[model samples]
Target chain A: MYKEPIFLQPKFQERIWGGKKLHTEFNYTIPNDQTGEAWVISAHPNGPSVIKNGPLAGKTLADAWNDHGELFNKSKDNHEEYPLLVKILDANDDLSVQVHPNDTYACEVEGVPYGKTECWYVLSAEPGAELVIGHHAKTKDELTAMVENQNWDTFLRRVKVTAGDFVYVPSGTIHAIGKGIVILETQQSSDITYRVYDYDRTDSVGNKRELHLDRAIEVTEVPHQDADKEQSVSTVHQLTVKKLVEEKYFTVYHWHLFGQASELKLNQDFLQLV
Target chain B: MIDGEATLTVDGKTFEVEKGSHFILPHGLSDYDLSGDAEFIVSHV
Candidate 1:
């Protein structure tokens, strides 16, 4: 019997490649200039969003999901945790080249409920901004050999991007967010990242970040292929709906409201995030 | 909502929302009404 919208407070995370754009662009009171990501709508144990209104005010989204399952149309047969996470990332510098495991690997090896299969909606980008999208390896052996030989230039595929662009990075896809890019990301609620490579950047303590080479080699898709997402567009009243990517885990849409529209919350089992 | 202001009525409660406002309309809620001029980007599972 729930009504009213649920507004959640974002939790910020700091990273070496982070910047102040989350604050500058979103007017969020970022913790520091190095803040990298704002977990806007999340229920992960690492950083759950706090509800800001109604009877659930002050409760974490995790609490609501576990306690008030009906709000999410959860039934007794479904025991899985919340299925999605939304984030805003600001890459002041290049992020580490990385890949993530799929559900089977994540559960069997990492003991996590879900694996990370994420999509990015570029909020803004600097001129010539590029991202590591995939690799040039023809096979798993080639991929391993290139990684072992440190032949980065010949092994990685970089793509130029700009504002309003959308990229879908599926599980096992070797990818990285290049410098000076800000994006909104939607993904499975998991944080298991296997860093394939870092640009030899050292921390303040003069220690280089650890690289999960073995796991990365194990999970990365050899001869990486870009995901094929067929976008569809439609309009209802003042809202222009753009279907970005529809996959097994989740379907993402971009809604552009020009004037006004009366939206009905149909008897769907899942809640909507804005 | 991304831009402009709006009054959102859910059940018998009302909320004032403006640009940059992010919200989730819970499942099973009745037909909520939004009146005003605004832009928004929304997603769901």
Candidate 2:
């Protein structure tokens, strides 16, 4: 029986808003100065994590899910590509205002298995750091008018963030991560993003990024609703555990171990990404 | 014990782990041994 924990090597992605924080903070050997995200525990085809130890060493997480289905306790009812992805994002600049489709919309329009409904655990933030959460649009017509007019200052809602703060972002929410912040993100496996605005920022080659205005309008919720989350704390073994959010996509928790704790590898019927 | 040390033994192979070290004990490994003290965080799906 496979009982050893699988440690995976992270895959990094370069972005226009990327920076060197991933290297300075996590001591990661980043690919470049524009490294924006580390796909820490992921099985997505774009950047699947490679197992670094044990019998699975050198194999991508996607490989294991496809070949050794038993490891994740894959059964008839759970046969949708890998279900989750974990990432650490370093936003040196603002990300483009974007939204994502849910499962039904994704499968019908994007031909993907899942949609993005992510939550962020703030790792660190500079003083007065903030992020774009919801929009100020009270109705679909208002949202459309604001986007058409490019009225960003009056349309976006920004929220201040600090270390240890948690934010749940469900699908169809128009959001973006502002500059000077690093976040640990957990979400559904799909990566179908529909960009609404890009701040007129051009790439190194001076080309503006594409905006999917039509799709964004179709998928985004008419009025934004913040996720209602009530965290609960508990002690398990010698670790302090805090439940972050339990939603349709996933249940996330933060564990702080103060001493040595022996944990048995039980058959959980599901894989964990840490 | 973020400031302490711990020795983790998996399948009879033991190693000393300290603060800021990140390691995984994969599934299917036998009951392992962890001695000493240390601090860490773990998350699972």
Candidate 3:
């Protein structure tokens, strides 16, 4: 049985809309100037974090979940890939407007265990930074017409945001993180995305990225449904515990402590970040 | 996180945690102690 906390080394990903804030702000040794994301506490096959402390040092987080199921209170026969992924995304440029399929669609069409239902906690945003959280289309045909007409200004719904703001993005919500904003995202351990818009931006190689309008439109909710989350705060041994969101996929908390907090326990699973 | 340092005690073992430090206190960890000063954002499923 492991008695010490498990530290992890993040795995970084390069992206077209990335920047160097992962290095500048978080002090991480990023791979390049376009270091877009840091998979901080992830076990997904795409970018699993490596353990950095105790007897499991140098093992991948996937290893811990696979080899030591008891560490997460899972049975030895449990074969589900670790279910949650935590990431820090630095959007130097706007991300592509995208949506994800639900779990049923993912299992039937994409043959995956889970779909993507993510939530973002804004870490920082420029003075005038904005985000695309929903769309203005009221029907499937209207949404398709807008996407086909290249009418982004009329089709997208924008919201201004700042540091410490939180947004819940369930599956099929058309969303994008605008430029000059950084966020911590928690979501189901899946990476299936369908892009609808990319601002007509070309990559360094002068090639345009693919747009999955057909799938995106097919999966998107006809009428955008805003996720209204109720938050509550309390004190646990002097630690201010703010329950951020409790949902079917993930439950998050923001904790603040100036002096000391004692006797924090966990019999399930946990991830901690600054 | 703010500028500060703290010692996290778990099962009689202590680990130093500061700004930008991330860790997980896996399942079966019943009790842990923290002292000094620091901030953390934790998640679970």
Candidate 4:
């Protein structure tokens, strides 16, 4: 029986708005100061987390999920990619306004099993830090017009955030992580992103990144609605558990340990802890 | 999870989890132990 915990090595990714906070905070051996994200517990094909211990050491997370279904309590007859991913992001600068497609749109167009629905647990946020959670457009046509005109000041919506905040970002919500924020993100195992705007900033190579306005507008939900969740907290011995979100794609929890908890029983489903 | 080192016990084996270490508690494991002074975020599909 596969009883040991599956340790994963983070896969660092560089981004235009990336910074050195990942290495400074996580102590990861990053490739450069521009490291933006660490795919901490991922099984996606783009950047799978490598197993770090036990017999699975050196094997990619995808390998384990494909070869050892029992470990995940998945049926042998079922065939699907691992459906959850955990990431740590350091946004030193503003991220491009972006949106993601739903599962139906993803399957019909991108031919992927899941779309990007994600949530973030703020690890650290500089004072006055803000995020573009949604937009002010009342309709799709309005949103399209605002985008076409580059009317960001009046078209975008912003919210100030602090450390220890939880943000839910459902697919189709136009959002961006503002500068000076580090977050631990739990997301659906999909990499498809539709960039809506990029602040007219060019990369180190002096070229603008491509924008997926057509697809982004097509997938974006009109009249943005905030996904508000009622949080519930409980204590299990010394560990205080806060249920951040339990949604269609994933259920997330924050565990604050005052000391230690021993002999914790596991449920049938596999859990990714980060 | 993200934080200081956490001591974990699975079956009869013990593992030391460092800061920023992320792991999966796969199925078929009945009970485990976590002894440390740290925080963690756990999720499932």
User: What TM-score would candidate 1 get against the native?
Assistant: 0.95
Residue lDDT tens for model 2, A62-89? 8888778777767646667978888889
Interface RMSD of each: 2.2, 4.1, 2.0, 1.1
Docking class of 3: medium
Query: Judged by lDDT against the true structure, how good is candidate 4?
Result: 0.90
Q: Taking the tens digit of each residue's C-alpha lDDT, what string does model 3 give over A48-139?
A: 99999878899999999999887888877779899888888999999999999999999999999999999998988999999999899999
Candidates' DockQ values? 0.61, 0.34, 0.68, 0.85
Candidate 2, residue A216: lDDT: 94
The 10-residue segment of model 1 chain A with minimum total lDDT is A265-274
Clashing pairs in 4: A274-B1
| Isolated chain B TM-score per model | 0.86, 0.76, 0.81, 0.87
Tell me each candidate's TM-score.
0.95, 0.89, 0.96, 0.98
Report RMSD for candidate 2.
Answer: 3.0
Ten-residue region with minimum lDDT total, candidate 2 chain A: A264-273
Weakest ten-residue segment in model 1 chain B by summed lDDT: B35-44
TM-score (chain A only) for the predictions, listed in order: 0.97, 0.96, 0.97, 0.98
Q: In model 3, what is chain B's TM-score?
A: 0.81
| Candidate maximizing TM-score | 4
User: Candidate 3, DockQ to 2 decimals?
Assistant: 0.68
